[model samples]
Target chain A: MSNLERIAKLSGFSKATVSRVLNHSPHVSQETRATILQIMKELDYVPNRNAISLSTGQTLQIGMITSSINEIMLPFLNGFVEVAEQHGFQTIIYTTNDDTSKERQAFEDLRQKRVDALVIISCVTSAKEVESYCKYGPIVSWQRMDNPAIGSVAMDQFKGYTLALDHLIPKGHTRIANALGRTYSINTRSRQQAYEQAMQKYNLPVLRQFYYPSTYTILDGERVMRAMLQQSEALPSAILCSNDHVAAGVLCEARRQHLRVPGDLAIVGFDDTELSHTLGITTIRNPIAAQAQNAFHLLSGPLRGIDMPQAELCFELIERTTT
Target chain B: MSNLERIAKLSGFSKATVSRVLNHSPHVSQETRATILQIMKELDYVPNRNAISLSTGQTLQIGMITSSINEIMLPFLNGFVEVAEQHGFQTIIYTTNDDTSKERQAFEDLRQKRVDALVIISCVTSAKEVESYCKYGPIVSWQRMDNPAIGSVAMDQFKGYTLALDHLIPKGHTRIANALGRTYSINTRSRQQAYEQAMQKYNLPVLRQFYYPSTYTILDGERVMRAMLQQSEALPSAILCSNDHVAAGVLCEARRQHLRVPGDLAIVGFDDTELSHTLGITTIRNPIAAQAQNAFHLLSGPLRGIDMPQAELCFELIERTTT
Candidate 1:
């Protein structure tokens, strides 16, 4: 006999009743469902997930579209995956490598019903294009969106950047150099604006010689410091980095040059990674864990009886030895 | 008209011809398939992946079951995801957190045809239990297994450990202490064995006081050093760590205590992560990227006209400032 028939015979329930329990239908009582599941477990019955997915229209899977898996993205991904697993949902990741075509393909996969929902991290595609897929499934993004139909849980990067500058400027640091990563990204633009606005508020000049454009890495951070030292203009008393890796890099290079931190060249970094805590680099806590949890909850809102338009998590300054 | 009918009308082909192209049938000529696909793209037709999966009995999705998303797993996961995406396959990740039941469920998911293949990274389940699922679909593992039915791509941890010891012992270091991570794991056991064997080969006594049991983190490294300092025994001249993070932590604590590196205390670390490079710690290269690529290829071997029983990648020693 088939596994379903065997389960029906053992549980004293009809085949249809056992099938309902397997599909997780609400029509069956909890007690009766438990009994049937126990028998199925005893029989070592493994239900076909694809068949159930087709019937219930629930894949029990969450898809995430990311630019790349690097130092900055790892923590966020880890947090997101933890939350997803706790909720009994598997995560399917599509790394687009910042390619618009790949991003579109990821959205297309969602439309094809591969996953129940999608959370996009650092998207390169336009908002309008992304918004079009909301009809297919719930779509969430790391960037804040104007449309109420889409869900977003973004960290206030502008506030975070200002928090860094605010900490440095009070220590009589007017000539603060800055490191920006990926000039085209919205996050980077907001951070740049924050630096400019904070400088203007304090009546400080935003000089070209102080600008360092490098991606997130310790090597990048070291390269920025090297470039600064080689420049003909006088070095800034303080440098604000894009992330902890860059900050750590700056600290390494500064140490090599016998520059005393906070005395000769103060450093401030974003994303309080493990590197920051280990090396004691003062940085802004990006709240990546909270963002991941909030994003997952927002995407799974309908199922969990939760309703919210958007969530803007706050970033806090973590003081350490560097500053 | 339906998507298939629309594509058929636009491409001047019958509905069955377009359907064959959509399902990726071997009967369809490449030239014909290309023409139909172009027309479907022009019309913005997205054939349902679930429907195709049902008919073809292929999900075109690879499932990975891992313990957790930590420092070591991140690189492997990223590498695997990149390779899978290049082959037009989506990756579904199941973070079991070393839970045997969850590991079983991951295999059951494979048995139920949710994925075409599965990769088990750091499994807690017994080989027999894992081998049972091979009949359902292909299952690859990170750890080396004696069973030929199961596919495996493992790095020789024994050689990796010896590589570290050989590099250190040559510099007239006899009193070498070791820090081990995850004592329960086979990899850790192999590393411990290698250390003991190397010590025996050099006619050096393996002191119990020098053995530090700590996991893979910079914090753990610092704690080990602190614990050692509090003990009555004199500190060993050189120490070996499980990974770069631990090495970095030891360095930090050593510096805090004003101990001179390579003079007062020589250090060696494994996994040559970014921390090792930035801090100039000598370490053994783990070759995580190569392991990932080889594992994926081994799992997808049947499809690519490649047949291999197993693959064992080697590790190399990288000399840095600390040694």
Candidate 2:
């Protein structure tokens, strides 16, 4: 017999009653519901939830919004999709070019389509821009500034910076430079503050010329490093980069200038991405996969009925030849 | 009156008729369609196609499948999404861990969901594995071995290698070490063939010890370079790397060993990825963004009877500091 017929026979109910129970109809009695459910359990029968939802006019679909597409965000997106798939939901991705207007439009579009939840990864958008949309559905953000109305999941940038600085300061490096990301970003600001604090704690002088603003790309890092090298000043003993991509750039520039990495300029980087392990660059590790996983859980779990959780992830300092 | 009602009144039809015309229903009469479309144009009505698609399942949606997620594929994915969006359709994404079983499962899942098209960006599966699924949708692949049953989009790896070798051979580097990717990859085999042909053209003896198989990551490049340094009886004048990521590794390891690039060991890389631009590594440039755009056009355009032109792109040679 077919699975559905077997389920009907085991439940000791008519096939019509079994079908109603499977569809979760309001017409079913409590005792009939219990009997049908017990039979389904005994027979290990699994219903096609999507088909049921379709007939009932309910869809458990979520939308994910991201700013531009590139390698830096792929891992996080992959992690989010994996978690989303496991929860029996499909994600509709909307990508904007880091434009605030485009981001707003994407939110409106997804909201109009009635996505059950939204996960945004736009670093440039302010909390106010996304506030109205949150009222329409459960909203969760990753690695951006916190919003009281929506859930947020981000790496502890300040702690990550401290870990990198802590590793460098003990190596007796007094003159240090930093290749940081854009000044406007929360992550960059946090790391910058941590860098300044670490410098003060180590009793080292902080120079304005030593801080370079980069766009988190390897080429940006290299360009900033080259500009710093051309200046009429002595090179720093070490350079602290905002991310692994930028650090790869700094390493390239240092090589071009014929400067030794650890011997001439001990370098440390953030985001201990997969590239870090391959390049042997000493870096501070931020659990990006864990961040994505937690964000998904906050937006889709049973506890979603409650307020979003504010939590910080642990980071580690990985030592390699760059330091 | 609402915009829909106004358009309906102007077109001498109900609001539903205007919507049906806006959605390009095959059932609508040509004269009635022209009248309704003209009314929509006169009213300057902009339809939310995504919302319409969500409500009515008429337009085609394509699914893009990838094995690994990284920076190299970001631009390509972005290009694909932009093209798909422009064609009044959506692109869904699925990522696998480069496992054959996982890849097969992803294909099956997408097929079961009835996506209109599939664009794969990894190793090519067996013809039999993809045959049954291809019957359900059009399948296009990128950066994999050419399969007769599926249309493919790929960079010219042999030409890319020839470009790199042409640049290096003229630079008087007779003894050149090579860092290549996995032997199983079709691109790797093509590049290896080019390397052999180039060596023969220059009458240079092939040094087996100087060749290393490394994955396309900076750390792998570094490890392979270190091993080459430790194992090779003689150092080559230059190194030809598989890609920029690996080239960055070799550059880093050479710096650690206190060997000067170009001075001690000149280098060349492939793909000319963003990392290559940052490091100023002389390499071959593949138009990944263009390839992605073409793939999207093929799946969502004429292949779907949409009004889009078909096109193909080519690769170029970019020279920088490593050579």
Candidate 3:
């Protein structure tokens, strides 16, 4: 016989009565419940969480759907998990690698009640398809979403770019260049647009030769910087990089080529990571931890029937000697 | 009514028969099974994984207990998750921050049947305590365990140190120093022993002043290097850093102080991460991905009744300009 059946037979109660006692239904009398609990302890009948979830309808899990994992995503994940663990929830990360079908499967996990809520760090899926699942559970994203029900908490990438450019232009730099990450991402697009607009504002020509599409690694920075140095055209007065790693690469390559930083080419990097601090690279401080915290609160607040205000987090610029 | 009862009513079958069909029991007639499946589809009846897990005793999930999340842990996690996903299993990571109680709770999660197997990256708990839970499920770790049931797949830290020291000694360096991460870790202890052994083998004295206990970040490297520079004793002719980040920091600080690398201070780094590639820091290639893969295969093969050999992975020395 199963543990439940054994408990029922030993306590002189039906299996349903034993289950009711296990679930704390309160319909069972105090004396009968005490006897059932005693028998359960003697039998070492530890209640399975699966059965408990079936009765309670709460998995106590929060699902996170991320496109990729890297150094940039580390702090954000750490912050989100910190808040989640405080509220007695575990975060299940599903890395989809920007595949729409895999992202849809993650949403299906939400529909199946494997998790109480879902947080989309990044995705390739349409906002409307994502919105359809909001009714099933609370959904939040780091990107801006059209649906009012879906929580949108994100950093102002455009402002981050403008801040870096503003810092450079005042230092007598007119022929400036920009090296960014994948063009497909929303953050990259925003920064690229800002770069163009800021150049237009200063009446500086936007040189096509100066643009470099770089990846997030330090080697990508070195590759792009090498290409820039090899070109016949005079190097741009300054360059804006995607992140500190890429900037560190740019600095290393420039040193290799015997080019003086700020004397020959002024460089600005984004995401004031630890590398930036070590190398004294001036960078824009992306508010990753704050954005992650906001995303979590947006997910949990609504479940408690508390209204959360939709807001965009801001970025800041940290000045160092490299600029 | 629950979806199960609704499907039964629509198919004119008993609830138990519908459940048997859902559970894929061969006792159900083929026609009846087809009809019940059709009814389930029509009603949009999605079987809950929780209920299915209770019946099948398979959660299709793997539990990972890691001490913390940092740059060092990222690749190991990526490798493990990739293999786990390919095998149709999801990995649930529990960051214990080396907290003994929290690590025990993760083990308890296994005993409660939440995960089919457990992979321990690092923990503060004793081996015997960890081994007791092996009978509950498949267990694997990056550290060596006394129990035969637990899988041990780890890199040879002693050999890694000896490789670095031997490489440096051939270059005519006697005043060599070493900087490492948390001293309490087994990896650190092993490396320290190897450093002492290699120094004695060379008939050189191990100076206490030259030993630095540094963390994983580049900033720690800078701090230790700064302290070394200010000391009354002459700086070591060469330094062996625990990892690339610290090595990178030492190089940066040396440059700031106008000390030429390999001229004033030669350096060797461990964990040939992306940073090492960018800065051309000679390092020991810690095979993290291969170790993660071995750990997963060890866990899965045993569950299939396939005996896996207990093995220790080796590290390699990457030649670069820093040395």
Model 2: which residue pairs collide? A71-B71, A278-B219, A279-B219
Summarize candidate 1's per-residue lDDT along A29-94 as a digit string, tens digits. 979988997886777666766666776788878889888888787778888899877665678988
Q: Is candidate 2 or candidate 3 better by TM-score?
A: 3
Against the hidden reference, what TM-scores do the models get? Answer: 0.88, 0.74, 0.83
Order of candidate numbers by DockQ, starting with the best: 1, 3, 2
List model 1 lDDT by residue over B132-239, tens digit each.
Answer: 999988888876665688887777689999988888888988888888876677777888899899999889978668788756787888888887778787888889
DockQ of each: 0.51, 0.28, 0.30
Top-TM-score candidate index: 1
| Clash pairs for candidate 3 | none
Give each model's whole-structure lDDT. 0.82, 0.74, 0.81
True contacts kept of each: 0.60, 0.40, 0.48
lDDT of 2: 0.74
Question: TM-score order of candidates, best first?
Answer: 1, 3, 2
Provide the lDDT at B181 for model 1. 76
